[model samples]
Target: MKKNGFKVFIVALMLLSLCFGTLGAQAAYEKTQPQTITVLGTTDIHGNVWGFSYENDKETTNTGMARIATYVEQVRAEQPNVILVDNGDTIQGNIMTDDLYNKREGAHPVMTAMNMLGYDSMTLGNHEFNFGENLITRLQALANFPILSANMSRHDGTMAALPYTIVERAGVKVGIIGLTNPNAPRWDGEKVDSFIYSPVGPACKKVVDIIKNKVDLIVVVAHVGMYPEYDEEFGSDGANKILELCPEIDALLVGHAHSTVSEIIGNTLVGGARNLGREVVRFDITLNTDRQVTSHAVSVIDMAGFEPSQALRSEPFIAKTHQETRDFISGGVTSADGTTSGGIFGKASVDFQPKNEIMGMPEGKLRDTAVMDLINAVQLANSGADVSAAALFSDSSDIPAGDINYGTIFGIYKYDNTLYRVPVTGAELKAYMEWSASCYNQAMPGDLTVSFNPEKPGYLYDMFSGVDYEIDLSKPVGQRIVNLMYKGKPLSDSQKLTLAVNNYRYSSALKAQKLVAATKEWESPNSIRDMLVQYIQENGTIYPKVDNNWKIIGVDFTSPYREQVVKLVNEGKLEVPYAKSLNVNQLKKDGILK
Candidate 1:
């Protein structure tokens, strides 16, 4: 009886040991299961904190920091491991940031909102330097998160900001390298003179080599687009160059071109969101127990679908600043001393631009208008240049017949660009005009209305004042500019002329494109926007007058089908032609406009 009892005890002990071993194996398997990590990114927020357009004096549903905040909160709640980042161009754009917050001393509204949103890190965009180095430093000090620029360095060779930051989530370390656009010096002019910029590709390679082994995943947040904005020989301003140099990058998020980008390049996941918080890029990365990225997916979420977060909008500083901005735009601001400023600064006699014949087409670009003329006149008057060039920045830009306020001025000229007077030979001027004329799509036979080139952004199509010229659509792009005259005489190729252009145009287009060999002779002390306000304030009332110095010729829109297409577009039955030119023939070919 004793032997049988002992045998039973041994059997029970063996079974218990087996059961414990099985449990341990199950725990090991669970630990090795793939874990998902999510990375959220916002780019080119451009000071839309309240998701409102101070220029239009209305609430914008499609964009703003508040909407981004709401979407981010939703993402954080759904995911166990999430990281938030901003790609840059956050500081200066509209009236609020450019006029109000950017000038003030304490916390910047954009930085304040970003801090509240819990941005992990931010890459420095070119526009961030618009207010100069001092403002950038103040903003950096105000930000709770790291402001990173690996490619930018001070004279002492130290990095301008943190090169990269590592964040750990779910035991997975992510190394995010921030690369600013090298062409910042070009666009920002002297604002970026204190710092030195190196090519993005080499700078990224160097950083990756140092941090690749230390982190489980390597991601790059670049303030550059996928393709080069200009010639690559000048400097690398695209993320594609970075990937070529650092193929080990697990993912890359880019901005600055303000276009939606989502694609997979080899093993790396690449994504970019649109400007002004219009979209958010989400990257989901799955990793194994060994911390190797197993799989990943990238998507761009539109902000229109998300509601603005009341919590973010109601944040003390944001709420107060938003109302103050609106007040400053409409009425004026009363200081602590009881002195009010910034309300009706000037007046306009009539609307600057005429109504467009075709929906979504900019008539101002097709011919000279008071809006462009006034901007050019301001540049010419301020700088004493013989000639001036400016662009109709937005299709909707116009000075309405009413009291002129800061918002009204902003509508006329959106960018905070300083005037630059440069000396250009008549040949160089012609070359520049030819380049600008290329913004129009080549008109073919049977085409009803003139259309702009989809690839050429409206900002690039500059119209010249102080010169008489015509863009002949019958001619090719290089030979489009004809009847070029200055001071009632044909402009000779050897004739020297002083050209007034914005600092941005001088650097990005004139110098970068090698279109002109001239150097800037003068720069305005104030922004062109400020000059416009001063001009209006001094004149009391401005009139809309077109000199008829320039016009588009050689294109015939006499087709009866043109009216039908325009009607359809205006009625919303047919979509506005943007991605490609939609003429009457094409519409009929598709059987859309019968």
Candidate 2:
């Protein structure tokens, strides 16, 4: 009886103590003055550390981690309570970065720079898994900050990453929950096969449920950007959807679209930065004495003209590696002066100059272009596929006539997509062409230029080689391809042919998104970039000329905007054959047409 009475007393005493402790902590927190915190973030940095463009082998004014470092220092100096964060896609864009990445060595320059920047936390972008799960794990281990991704899980249902992390500052707890794009598995293919992605809305809700009561403030660092509506068919994981789904989230940082966004989405504060470390999105948050978020302001700090820190540049290890990369890119492989044989020594007796040709001409009227020809030639020689499909990655991509180096290689091919050979029926090939043709808007009388479908990205429009075809823009979307020919013979719908394409285009998950159909025949571990490099190394010189295989069938040449359109094309204002019509309107508004 005595023992039972003693046990009851102890339990009651413990409960009383816990209650008082909570009340005391709350009272003390309420008594303190409200603290203000500044949150600075960067997204989709894409391996830009030196403010350098490897394609052009020159420094650009817009990007670099060094500039971001200076900005971060400036922000920290002003606000002692500042916390730095990164939204993902940090690695794997530049040539130097790719060189190190392909090595799979522990020495990652991008991660090294991020650590130096002192990031608090980061989320995963789809591109982070491009090198595969193992490499991503290695990269994640290198980060001093917690890399968060709540939606991703192993096939066995174990969390691939932490859902949220709470950091305490000035007696207040701030919870940061991360959500990656749910469409990752579709785009990254086998690279993310072992993982499952949860719907972002549910994932955000799950994290919020776990962290809401524990923290004074909640910040969502999601790789998904803001979009008007949820695209279930395309698997879009937009910020607006999360804000709609989770009311407990206080602030949101978003990326993956590479769009500069800073605006209030309902009651939540949201923002994103441009690609390649060009700028940083800043959020200044104010809290009440009770530790509730009161007001938040957001802005973008452009990195242009921001000087890089000499200390960072002078870091011995990074400096040495960077210099080696520069040298490798600048060095000539094969020249007329009888340089050491890298491949086919001096195959072209004369220097190969890439002619700047207008892209996106309507079918039947399409002219052969040096750009498409060069890419097609490389694909044909490497894949040996009967037909090759290639896209114009960039309108400005060009290789000078005098010399070609690693820089030129990246210039021509911006992505590190692996080569794929897929068996496709002639009907499917035509359907693919039709899908590619959808990239361009129909030519209208008032339309000053051949504009692109604003809904589609430029990289989706593919130009083909090893086959001759005509595209009629006047026809309906699915009926664009006509007069298609293979080896000077009319292509029949039932005929089967091997087509060379990139892994991104051939991805089963991506094919559904793109509405392309094909049967995979073979895939190579070899990257198209490496293939191009090897081809150049073998053939000492490249002679790029178009076969005039594809043409645009119908364009209203008599349109009132003809002269102005021609002028724009000549001046290179029409960089993308299919640009948004807004671009045309802008030119007219600028009086460039008059």
Candidate 3:
């Protein structure tokens, strides 16, 4: 009996020992649960290749797609578990799209290059809507990776999804869902007409619910940059709207506003703007079975750091692509000059040529006088009728003449604006003049704020010379403009006049369209930019001269001139030389010589 009991004990002990050893090995595996995810992502590339930027100067040899390809290669080599993504707006804003548009060809060369470099996913941006439905569909077909938008769909409210992809790395499944920004109509205009955009919050929740249960991790590529890179100083992206509403997401890959944020929001990790599309973001994540990420690491790399990968930088293909791009920009045909031409801006000359006048249009002090008069000449010549207040000024683009490329033309006139001749009753005309004066209202922070917002910089810094006005920062928003008048006449309420203007501001394409609503509208036969090109085409070389028409009215409203005399005599105020001068024009002409 004792021997039998001992044998039974030994068998039980052996079984227990084997079970304990198996448990120890299982615990070790659980502790080191192998998983690492890196998303090499970018946004708002806007076809900027070789780090292209014309904002500061004529041209810059910035980072390009080929370099980015090489960098993507290097990153993948270091870690095979990385996914490459683009946030959106990759279709336009460069010469690549211009070629495609002009030639009626395929999608961007940059897109092709990105595909060769291995982009795993992408989203739609507002600019993508500018290409219209057909082109977007074409682009969708060409994309090697899934282009996604949770909030965007066909004309109705149904879910539009590409076959959702699950990428497994180290035995971990990551589900990536795409969410596109919904402000397409406000900015894109007629191009993407009936495509409905649902509110982002509900759509996000739906996607999260759909993916969270099925995968261990969730990554959202958000094109909704709440506070766009364009709005840096605010530190508050308009995008906070979506983030505030959607908390179910585990990780967000943000774009649109184009700022970077490696942030924790409601158990989610969000980051963005991987170096202007010249780089990608790599993120490492660790997760629990509840499918929640417990730890993570993020890094970004610039493509310019690497050599051009052979797949993207082929010389024969580049030369062929270059000529094709050029041809498309030249309106499917090249001008006699080796450059492409757009619009019809020509030195058509002052229509009447000031039959009895002399002194070369009277050496105008303001720039728009001769240009406005010249436009009036063409209008009257075409209509055989007297017209009032024709506006002609250089289109607002910072591109230099030497650097005039396809991007310049597109930026200057993204709106397909035509010229309009509107006839308004004198009262309506006076009201419009007042409102136009109001449109002149803008305040630079440097002029008033203790410090300027460096992050924001000012918008393009426009210098409008055609219609004169004033702004007083102290005054309320609507009351800043003073004593509005036109053509040196106190504008009568009942009198009528004809006004010429660009269709963009005329129709209030993006903003309030009602400002110029009172006047009857007409489309100019050619765009103002086109008119300029036509003018240049007629002449070999070009020099724009001053065309004086408008001037600052109600100078007395500018300040209390007489009160300063008291301050000056009594030493109440510091001696500001020009401040004391009542006649600004005379003061300027007097020069700086003491």
Q: Distance (Å) between predicted and true CA of 475, model 2?
A: 2.9
Best by TM-score: 1
Residue 227: error of model 1 in Å? 1.1
Q: Please give, for residues 1-594, the per-residue lDDT of candidate 3 as tens digits.
A: 999999999999999999999888866565466556677777887765544443332333335566667777777798767877777877776554543442254545665666677777777776676656776777777778787887777766554545246666655677777767665765554555667776655666677777777877777777776464423443223455556666766567777765556666767677776435655556677666544576887656555556655556564554355455555454564432234554222323332112212111111211234334444444444333324443222223322334333344444444333556666555554444444433232333212111112332222111233234443433433454454455565556565656655443443321343444454455566545455445445563434444443443323433333344324434634233211222333433455212
Q: Name the top lDDT candidate.
A: 1
> Candidate 3 clash total?
40
Ranking by lDDT: 1, 2, 3
Worst-scoring 10-residue span by lDDT in model 3: 356-365
Taking all chains together, the TM-score of candidate 1 against the true structure is 0.89
What would the per-residue lDDT of candidate 1 be over residues 1-594, giving only the tens digit for each residue?
Answer: 899999999999999999989878866675577778899988998888889988767899899999999999998999978999999899888877877777778877788889999989999988888888988799789989899999999999887899999997766788999988888877776778899988888899999999999998888999988877764664487788888889999999989989899999999999999899999999999998877778899999999998899999999988988888888777667532343335887888989899987778778877888999888888889999888999988888999898888888888788878889999999999999999999988777766667788768899989999999988887888999999999999999999999999989998789878899978988888789878888888899999878989988876667777777778778888776653455666776888867
Deviating ranges (above 4 Å) for candidate 2? 1-31, 228-236, 331-367, 508-510, 513-518, 558-561, 568-594
TM-score of each: 0.89, 0.85, 0.66
Superposition TM-score, candidate 3 onto the true structure: 0.66
Per-model lDDT? 0.86, 0.75, 0.53
- On TM-score, the stronger of 1 and 2 is 1
